[model samples]
Target: MSVELNKTLFNSRLKLIKDAWNNASDSEEYGSIADVGAFLVMAGDPAGEDDPIRKGTAFQQIKGGDNPIAIEIIPQAGAKEPSNDAIPRFVQAYISHSRVGSLLKETHTGKLVKEWEALLAAANSRPELVEISPAMSSFMAVKDDEELKIVRTAANLTSTLLANYIATKLETILDKEAKISHEDFSAQIEARLGSGEGDDAKGPDMKVWNKNPKLKDVDWGSTELCYSPIIQSKSTASGYDLKSTAESSPDMIAHSGVFLISTGIRYKGYCANMGRTIIVAPTKEQEEIYTLLLGLQADLITNIKDGAQIRAIYQHALSYIKDKKPTLEKHFVKNVGFGMGLEFRDSAYLLSSKNNRQLKAHMILNLSLGFADLVDDAGKKVGAENATILTEGVKSVKDTLFFEANDEEELKSSKPKKPPVKPLTNGHSASPVKNKTVAGKVLRTKTRSAAQEEVLMTTAAKIREHQIELHAALQAD
Candidate 1:
C-alpha cells in the first residue's frame, strides 16, 4: 500500500512561507523591495533534501542522491486567473535529468552546490531579496493538527519498537556473559522495525528515502532513522558526549553496567525520538541518580505549557537541578528540550538559555534530561549504561506535543487530586495524575513522594520568587 501525501497540510505550509516572503519584502527592515525578486531556493538529497525549509514548502518528497535536485519558491503578486489558487504555482522543483530520466533535458545535472552558489550570487546582486531560511524555520516549528497526527503515529511506532525490544530481547542479551556489539543490537532493532508482521505490515513497506531511489508508483513509508541508534555501555555511557558511529572495539554491550539506547524513526518525512538508559547490576549511586533523573524530567513536564518561555523553562530545570543536586549540574546536558517536527530538532524553538521564544500549542518537544560522569563511593568511574534492577521505564519526556492552554483557571480547577502514595510491587512510585495532553493523548505528571513533592514545591516557590527578575532578563534579550 502507498502512503498518500496530505496536500492540504502542504498547501497551508506553502501559504505560510509565501505570507512570510510577502511580509519580509514589504518591510523596510529587509531592504528596498522595488524591483527585486525574492526566491526561496533549496537543494535536495546530498545537499538540502532534509532541509526543513524545502520539506515545509514542497509537498512531494524529492529523492536526489548522486544527481541532486533543487526547489525554488517564488512569491507571485496575484493569481493570473480569477478562480485559480496561487499557492501551488509558487513552488517549482528542478530535478536533474539523471534522476528524472530522459523526459526532461539535462540542464541542471551538475553539483547542487553550484546551483546554490548561483542563487547566492543572484541574492548578493539584489539587496532586497533577503534569506528567508530563518523565517521558514520559525514558521515550521509549530505543527498543525494533521502534522501532529503523523508525528504522533511515528512516535507510537518508535515507542512500541523500543518497548518490545526491551521486554523481549534486552535481558537475554545483557544476561549472556558473551560480548555483544552495538551493530548486533542495532540490527535487532532494524529487524523489529522492518518485521512487516501484524500491524507493522499494515502500512506501506518501509524504505530509507535518502539512500534509496524515489518510488515510481507510490510513496513508500520512510524508515530512514532520524539518527543512528546510540548503544553505549559501561564507560562509554559515563559522559555526556554522544557516539553516532558504532564503537570499533567489540563487547560494546558489557555483561554489567549502564547501557544507553537512544533511537528515533521517521515515517512519511516526520520524525519521532525515544531514549532510555538501561542499568544492569547498578550500584546504589547509579539507581539513585537514575530515579532522580526521572523525577527531574517529571518536574520539567509539569512546568511546560503553552505561552511558557523556552529559556525560562530551561532556567527552571537548571534551578531545580542546582537546588537538588548541584554537583550533577555540570553533567546535565546543555539543552533541556527542543521543538521537533519536520526536522529532528527545530532550531528556532530550542529550549536553551539563549532562546526566548514562547511555546505554542501543537508544538512537539523531546525533553532530554540526564546525568553523566557519575562517580562511585570510591570515586571509580562506573557509568549508568544499563540498569536492570530499577527496570521500570524512566518517564522522561520523549515525543510530547502540547495542546491549547486556553483557560488556565479551568485547567487548574480540573487538576486531579493527588492520590494516596501507593508504591507498586516493583517498588516504583505510583503513576501520577494525567493532566496534560501529549502526542495526541493525555500525559500524566510524574509521581513524587510527599518529601520529594515538598522539595519540588519549594523549588517552584523559589522560581516564582524570581519570576520578576527572570521576566526582566528575558525582556532585556
Candidate 2:
C-alpha cells in the first residue's frame, strides 16, 4: 500500500481509540480499551510446529525458523471472495485477555473517567493538538486490514492513555515533592492505573474486594512497568530496566538513588512498553551523560527512514555513539534497537547482524543504548528508550513531546549542551575479545548435604503419596 493510504488508515484508527476510551470510560460493562487492540503474531520455533503448544499458530517458516501467522481459506458458497468483511486474509484470529484483565475491575471505574477527561482536556488545550490527533498519526500506520486496524489502533491509543496516566501521576508526585522509592512508585502506578494477575496485591482491602459485590471475583488486566535505582555501588552492575517482578532492591546508601522506571503494559489485548531513567538527586556527571544520550537519541531519530535497512541504521547509530563519547569505548552494548509490537520482542528487529530486512511503513521499533561508568560502575550511567512508530518520515516518541513535531523540535533546540570529555582511553585501541575455555578440564560434582537430601526425600514421599491417591481415584472411576 502507498504510504499516504497507510496514513489515512492510521488516522481512521486513531478516531477509534478515542471512541473505545469514551465508550469504556463512561459505561460500566463495555470495558475500557477495546477487546483486541493489536493483532501481534509470534510463531514458535519451526521445529516445534508439531508440538501441541505450537501447533495452531503458523505454517510458513523463514530461514531463522520464525513463521508467519497461519490461515485457512475456503471459497464462500458460490461467491468469488468472502463477503464477510470480518474474515481476515493473512492470519487466523485468536483473542487473549491477559493484557486487559485490569480494565474489568471496578477500581478503575472512577480513574478511567478522570483519565479520559484529562486526556480530552489536555488534548484540547494544547495548540499543537493536531499532532496527537488521528490526522497527524503519520509515524506508523496499520496494515490495510480492517480487523488489524482495530487491533493496532487499540494498542496505540491505550499506550497513549497509559503514558498520560504515568505523566499525570508523576506530576502529582513532583508537586508533593514525594521522596518515593522505585518499588513504591511502581506500586502506586499499578493502583492508579491497573495491574494484572502477575502482580497480586495483598491487603485487607484486596481480601474485601475479592468478596465485595461490586468488586469481587474480577479479573484485573496486565501492565508492564519496572522501577529501580540506577546506581547501587561500584561493583553492582545492574541494568536500569528489568522484569516487573524482579526482586533486586536498590541500596539506600545515600537515602536516594537515580530511579529508573520502565513499563510494558498489555492493555486489553495490545502491548505498550516504555522506560524512563530519572534523577531525583543527580550528580553533575550523571545529568551530563543523560543529556548527552537524550540528544544523541533525538539525532538518531531524525535519521530514520521508512525503507532504510535496519542494520545500516544501527551501525550508523553505533558510530555516532562512539564519536560522541570516546572515553568509554569498551563499555558499549551491541543492540541499538529492536522490534516491538503485540509481543514484547518481535520483528522487524533492529540488529546489526540481521541486515536482510528493511523497516516497513507502520512498523514500530525501539531504539536504546546503555552506558556503564567505566570509572565508577556504582555511579549510574545509562540511556533509556521509548517506543517509536515508524511513519513514512522521521518522528520520535518522547515523554512530553509524544509524536508531535513542534515540541520535538523545541526540546531538541533547548537540549542541554554536551559536557566536556577526556580523549579516548586507548585511542579506540582494543584487542579481539577472546572466548574463554578450559580444555581437558575435569568437572567435579558436589554431593548434596544431609539436610538437602532429607528435604528431597520428604518431597519425593509426598509426591509418591499424591500419585498413589490419584491412581486409586482413577481406578475407582
Candidate 3:
C-alpha cells in the first residue's frame, strides 16, 4: 500500500476513536451522562514499543522519541470538517521536533499542557478526566476495511515465507552434515524480510525453537538488533512467561525431530502470527498429536463468529478438547486467543473465561492453541513436546476468515470442495498431508528424502481434510 493511502486510513482510524469518545461521553458507564465531555489524553509508550492507542489514532510510522508522544482528542459538539486530507481535525498530536521525517511531526509539548490546564479552569462544571483507554480498546478491536487489507497482506506474506522459503528448504538447511546454527537460520529469515519480502513494521521478533533438549537454559545477552530473531530449542518455547528477555542459545539446528517456527511480520503496523511445527522424522505418536491439534484448531476456528461471547468461545474450545482428548485437556493454554491489531496482542478482547467481552465483526484474532509438556504412550517425553499452532483470522458476522497456507481457490471459495482421499488398503482413513501450495509455490517438493516426503505428504493431506471439514462446518452453520 502507498503512504498516501495509509494516511487516509489513519484519518479513518482517528475518526473511529473520536466517535468512540463521544459515544462514551453520552453513556452513563463513563459517568458522562450530563453531556459534559472532557479532553481524552492518550500517552505513547515511553520505551518506544508498539503502543495501541497512539498508533491506532495517529500514523503507524510515528514512535516515542526523546519524549513520550501524546495525542489529545477533544469531543466536539458537531461532526467537525476535516482540515486536511490526512489527519482528522479532532486529533491534536504532540510529537517532538527531533522525530524528523516522521508523519505528523510537531513540537507542541508546551502548548499541550497549557491548553489542558486552561480548559479545565475555564469549564463552569468540573469534568472528569475520564479514562478513555477502554473506549480506545473498543474502537481498535474491530478493524476497518483498510486495516483489514493490511492485516491480510501481512498474513499472506508470513504464510508465503514459512511455507515456501522455510518449509521447502528445511531438509537442506538442517542437514546433519552441514547444519545451520540457530542464529544463522534466524538471520536468513530476517534477511528475507529485509529484502522486500515483507513489511518493515515493528513487532515481536521471530522465534525459532529447534527443540533441542541440551541448551534449555542458555541465555545470550541482549546486544543484538532491536528485532533480532530469538532461537531456542529447549523443551518449552522461550518467553512463555511473556515478561522475560528473548534470548537464543548458541546451538545449531537439530539434525532431526520437531522444529517449531513461530513468526509474524508487521505490515503497516498490523501483525499477522503464523506458527508451524516441522517434524523431520516423526514417530507415530508425534503424527497423531499434531493431527489431533490441527483438528481441534479447526473446530475452534469454525466456532468463532461475531456477537459470540469471548468467554463462551473459549469455554467451547476447552470443552471440545476435553471431550476429544481427555489427556490433553490440562495441557491446553489458559487463553485460546486474543484480539490483534496495531498492538501484537490486544488485551481488551482476550478469548478467555475471565474476559466478558463479545466478539465483534471485523475483529482480528490470533488463535494460539496447543498442548505443552507433551508425553508419549510410554510415559516418556517426546520431541516437539510443546506442540502449538499460532494462526490468525478475522471474525465476520457469519463465518470467520482464517489465514492459512492453502491455495487461493481453497481460501476464496465458500463451497465445500471434497478433498481427494485415497484410502489405505487396510480400510483406514488416508494419511495426513501437508499443504501443496502455501500462498503460491509447492511447499514440499521432490527434493526431500522419501521418508521426509511421506511425512510431509501425510501432513498436507491432514491439512486438506481439516480444511474440508472446516468448510463443511461453516456451511452447516
* Top-lDDT structure, candidate number: 1
What overall lDDT goes with each candidate model? 0.48, 0.36, 0.47
Give the per-residue lDDT digits (tens) of candidate 2, residues 1-477.
Answer: 221224454456546445555565453323423343432323322322212222112111111122221234433223465354232221122222233212111122243345333444544232211112111111122222442332343333333433345545554554354555444555555554344455584322243223224323223443322222122211123443343344333432122244344554343333434555433334455444554555455455555556677678777766776787776445555556565433344433545545555655455555565564333356523433321111111111112211111232332455522222121111122222111111111111112342233224433233223322211100000
TM-score of each: 0.59, 0.41, 0.58
- Candidate 3: residue 260 lDDT (0-100): 56
Q: After superposition, which runs of candidate 3 have C-alpha atoms over 4 Å from their true positions?
A: 1-36, 43-128, 195-231, 234-245, 376-477
Local accuracy of candidate 3 as per-residue lDDT tens digits, 288-360: 5555555556566656766678888888988987887788787777787677766666666777888877776
Cα-based RMSD of the predictions, in order? 14.7, 26.2, 14.0
Question: Whole-model lDDT for model 3 versus the true structure?
Answer: 0.47
Q: Write the per-residue lDDT of candidate 1 for residues 363-472, one digit (tens) a residue.
A: 67766675545566677653345222121124322111112333434445665433222221112333343444322222223334533443345433333333212211
Comparison by lDDT, 1 against 3, better one: 1
Worst 10 residues of 2 by lDDT: 468-477
Q: How much lDDT does candidate 1 score?
A: 0.48
Compare the candidates by TM-score and give the number of the best one: 1
